[model samples]
Target: MKLSYPVHDIDNRLLLPAGTELSGDVLEDLISSNHTTPSQTLPLLEHGSVRKDIVKFISQPPYQLIFPEKQDISKLLKQMEKVQFVLPFLRSLDYFKQYDFTTYNHLLNVFALSTLLAGDLIPDYEERIRESAAGPAHDFGKITVPLKILKKRTPLTRAERDILDHHTLAGYVLLSYYKKDPYSLTARVARDHHERNDGSGYPRGINLNDRMVEIVAVSDVYDALVSLRPYRPISYDKRSALEEIVGLAEQNKVSWDVVKALIAHSRTDKPHYQEVEIPSEKRGAPPPGNVYGIIAEETDADASGTSE
Candidate 1:
């Protein structure tokens, strides 16, 4: 594999330059170093440069990216700056590099969308900052899961499914261990983001009452739907993604207020509304049994098992 860009070691030392071809040994070494030293696997670029479209989408309030030509970008960058911790954590993971849905990028989009929605729901600066931090950290536990399972296109068996479902608790534990504030929103979000209002989410079947968790949950689903997965050939269109979210809201699985906030922020009805291209690896056929949908299968299975 050829390097798409220059990579940096944990100390910010240059390890490989752009276009450097990676042999089997070199690749293994790089992955090992990333696991041990916490370094970036992808080429280094200017901060706030990657995923411009996501920044563009969440350009309203608290999140701004200042550009000479486009001032709308200014807000998105400002919001990102509040949660700078996300970058290093993202850089340290080399496993996501082969997949279309890189954790780094997916978390960035989720963080941006969650914060944008947070701006509407949360008024306090401190609370909003907490939400910003929680957004990216929600999936941090997936680092513990094997890459093979994360990328598998086949339906996960019972054991694999159980392991996958534990990611929420794993993420929460990881964040709690490292975070100075024991009550940090980041840790809570990691634990509760998958929890639904209907009490059907994993790691806990309790209905979530926290506003921040609800916001991140909706954002997570929205991004996942629009992102290309290893199991799916193409990403869902914006309308389909929105529709799925709306359905969740209708079912009381997520907060309707959050969904409306996303709709308003998206402005998809506007003439200039544009959909960002979500990167995907397109690795294999769609997973059987539930079409590889994020929360649908679990919800359906739970629903079927319940007595009316």
Candidate 2:
């Protein structure tokens, strides 16, 4: 008999003994969940410059781009198709929004933004999910980098910087065996995310091809600027982030088109998880049917009384 189990469900601090196997039923449950996520449709992009910014306005912040309900999958596929058509011009803009985003959220936004940028240039950018996943997950290896260094309010010693530099390599090894896409981007993005145009990047700046490395370069810097790094609190606003990216473009530090696309993306509602200084805020939150819709499936949080 097959046993069902959930890693998140079990929530045990320690793993079972190395050689010990789980009951068939428990193992089956975990494996099933791991393998059985409902297949989502490929996200579509009509314009390339900054899709997410518009998506925030049209779709609502709660709506997830890559993963949504099966009922919504068809819509996403259609959108992805649209993106293919207009992405050459539509940039993913991130200006400001109310949602609170953690590191993971920041990473996903950059990944999506960069993917949109690539899709504008490449027809089959969907295949770049492998690359997109790498864009954000690359820093997971920083588990050894110490939260202090990552979120530090002070300067770092050379020794601390050296120790922290191995995050990319560590991320690569961690994801190498993941059941999902191989740790393909883990090593590449993490290691090279820092490499610069003038061959000033770290981890053996091989001076990679301009085309291939541009995505990581732009995505990395954009996220860094927007994120509240250890030494800094409340990073740049979306517009400021866009300006910085453009500045890099002017220096030929990055492709002009890529910078333009990112600048466009900085217009997104949830841009970099920081709301721009404004006079007021939106009246109410979006419908629960958007992203937290999953909760409705489990707990019926969307009460019948709440009318459209």
Candidate 3:
């Protein structure tokens, strides 16, 4: 009988029940030949459940080892909140980059903040947990993208934007192959996270039914607000970031209720979203007294190695 691994985790560590090493190209081929989509997870698993050996592999080692930082993030919350913060993100981000999540801590931070805000939108804390995982992890496919392309000081050419947008689909491939369950929140996030309220979004212009995606979308907007990008130098302060998200709700990009809850979180100072303004598409600087700082170093082939 053929064994089934968690298709959602295909992009992470390679495992033929663990203790195996494969080159990147070969691993890509292995997954490509057997690519799965979130929509396919249920059918695949329904066809057969997770293999015991595969479960054994996922529960130990690299998953447990390379992810100490994610664990650190998880520890900040209590049991229910812990599930909301870690489990979903752990599964969703596996494909893009797996590590301690030390730098920016953007994905971890976004997941925690978004999930807490989104919990009431979805009933089962477990399902909400799945949504939390998919939230920041929606960008995992962008990991290998060259920093120059992402942070170009000038407007991105159509080609550049198109290439950058592929991260959504790339992320989809990463999550779908492992889980193959369309009903799962992580699957929905990968396939439809980029979708806009007015259908201007990319990959697929899906009008998703899940409220978790909407809740996560608000947090997604928040993370972009605080992050430093080449297109915009400063991200918004907490109050301004909250206002921007609220504006997005007025523009129909996110739900009004989600915006209200996020704003409350901002008042408490628990969230650290990226601080993007949907109307202006500009990032705001850090809110008052925020110790948060983001820096990038660029290397030019022609110039001497100075600070980027």
Candidate 4:
């Protein structure tokens, strides 16, 4: 099969650009390399056009989400293009055939949703960009997980679950290694996105105080609920997904304010998703102090806990 997009090595070096036809030798080589050195996760280009289209959709007026417009889109794409390491890390899942949705698309959905929610809470432009970038990078550690575990339809065994839970820390390590920023928003999101506010979530069960992590965590769960999974045949509708998030908020598992923002943004009054102004009374207070500073103090060892 021909390459749908560019492929990159673990070092962020381009292996092949989009449109490169895959040959028997190339496929064999990739398979061999993958098996021989499981730690080196390669990146691949997701459908660039699809990414641009998603951005365009969210960028239109009635601007429901915190997506970039034409010029902003150009800048964001350029920024992402420079972060070539992200693709290879994500493309590791390309080898798994049973995923309900491509990792790239899933990440894209999370990024869009996270940014939308972030825009509602965070007025800083630079921070919004960081949250947008973190959405895709949040699952980067899944690269370290074995494909067999990732594609399994049955419930994971206790040991299997433990291994799988390590993906958060793995993702954090990968991003930190590549980006060289231990406290980078991308790295922190990868590690903390799976956490819950009530300290019931996995990886580390600590209460998440950072708004960005909270936004990405909520967006990740929302997308996962609405998207089909190999283990779950049916994908929940958007309304159901929102309901689930609201339920979590009610239970104190997620941020209520973020959920309110998500509900406002996803209002069904219009034909398309548009931003709706949530009442100040209903909205949660913005996180206290410099959130990034709070995040910087955290370490990977903190989120090292796993779930069953």
Best by lDDT: 1
Q: Of 3 and 4, which scores higher on lDDT?
A: 4
Worst 10 residues of 4 by lDDT: 286-295
Q: Please, what is the TM-score per model?
A: 0.66, 0.51, 0.57, 0.62
lDDT of 1 at 42: 29
Q: State the lDDT of candidate 1 residue by residue for 1-308, as single tens digits.
A: 34443444333455555565645465445444444432222222234444564555344322232122255456655665656443445544333444534566677678767776777777695546645778877887676555666766655555455556666765654454444233578878887888888888876687976888899999899877766665565676666677778778778899877887776655534221123222233332322333463433445554343221
Pitting candidate 3 against candidate 4, the one with the higher TM-score is: 4
Stretches of candidate 3 above 4 Å error? Answer: 1-76, 79-104, 126-128, 180-183, 268-308
lDDT of each: 0.60, 0.44, 0.48, 0.59
Model 4 segments more than 4 A misplaced: 1-101, 126-128, 269-308
- 24-98 per-residue lDDT for model 2 (tens digits): 443344334443332232232332233454345223232232223445434433433432211100111111112
lDDT of 3 by residue, 66-174 (tens): 1234453343233223332223234434422233222124454455556566654555765335445565556655543445555456555544555566666555545
Ranking by TM-score: 1, 4, 3, 2
Worst 10 residues of 2 by lDDT: 1-10
Two-way lDDT contest, 1 vs 4, winner? 1
Query: Regarding TM-score, does 1 or 4 come out ahead?
Result: 1
Model 3 Cα displacement at 12 (Å)? 12
